[model samples]
Target: MKLTPLEIKQQTFEKGLRGYDVADVQAFLTLVSNEFEHLLNKNKELEHEIEKLTDRVKHYERVEEALHETLQTAKESVEQKMDGAKQEAKSTLQKAEMEADAIIKEANHQRQQIRQSILRLLDRREEIINGISSYLDNAKKSVNQFSKDDMGTFKLPKEEDLEESIDKVTSKSSYSRFELDEEDLEISSYEEEDSAFAPGSDRLDDILDEID
Candidate 1:
């Protein structure tokens, strides 16, 4: 059987005539038990320390694993966020380009509309100018016709009579002593009457100048 310190201390050898000295044996057993007990206590203490160190090492390993996982997760999250931001920026840029194209197209359409309106206005202006020109031409024809009628009513000199009057006035006149017969005076009166009405002859010419 196993022996404890107490058992070793209490153990007795049977008495014999010449076995061993009793006091020396008991003292030696006592000494051996004390030393063995001290060794056992030291071993237990070392085992406890080893257990604590093992637990600490496991804790550190767990912490390291958790930190690695967290770092990996953070890196993945950052990449995902960057990808999302890039896609969003691309989408926004495309939308802005489309809007810009639409705005340009609308501007071009509006410009075309304005050009068309200007063309229409120019056509209207041309029509107005043509209408006014036609009206003025008709008015000139009417005025010329009226003036011819008035001349006919006034019984103005014929071409032959006017030529005869010019010959008479120009014939043999002395620059220093000019004189006139009854015929010459009569012709001179007719010419004065013609001169009095001469201002009305240029109405058609004035109307033509305005049209030009």
Candidate 2:
């Protein structure tokens, strides 16, 4: 059977007439018991150390798993943010294009307004020139009626006032210098007042209404 330390100590051998020395047998047993006790203590210390190392390994594995999960989550979050940023960029670009188109359309409308104003100025200038021509023709036919004093009293017209007044002339149909029949170049001048003026006075209010 197996011998423990206490059982080894209790073991006794029957003495033979000269088989073994008494002191030698007892000394050998004592040595064996001491060695066994030392080995048992050493084995227990080694087992405890191994368990501590195994626990440390398990703890490290848990920490590594947590860190990996965190890294994966961070990567996913970054990807989502990038996706949102891309969509926002696209939306911003679309808004910018729409704004640019709106600005261009408004500018085109303003340009058309300017072109119409220029055309009106040209038509008014033509009418004023035609009226002046008719006046000159009438004056030539009634040259006897005009005295030298009357001629001297006639003022040299102010350039700014004459151009501005021509732009306001309402009788453009009655006094058009433009010839649809045959285009030609000619300059003319006219008196500000005449008897052939039809209805009431050509008031400033009427001119303002035509501009509107």
lDDT, candidate 1, equals 0.80
**Per-residue accuracy of model 1 over 105-169 as CA lDDT, tens digit each:** 99999999999999997887786677666666766766565466544557778999999978877
Q: For residues 1-212, could you state the per-residue lDDT of candidate 2 as single tens digits?
A: 76666666666899988788878888888888878777777888999998999999999999999999999999999999999999999999999999999999999999999999999998986766565556556655455444344655577679997787687675477656544433222222133234334222344344445445
Q: What would the TM-score be for candidate 1 when compared with the true structure? A: 0.46
TM-score of 2: 0.53
* Model 1 alpha-carbon miss at residue 130, Å: 6.4
The segments of candidate 2 whose C-alpha lies over 4 angstroms from its true place after superposition are 1-7, 118-212
Question: Which has the greatest TM-score?
Answer: 2
Cα deviation of 20 in candidate 2 (Å)? 3.6
Q: What TM-score, computed on C-alpha atoms, does each candidate reach?
A: 0.46, 0.53
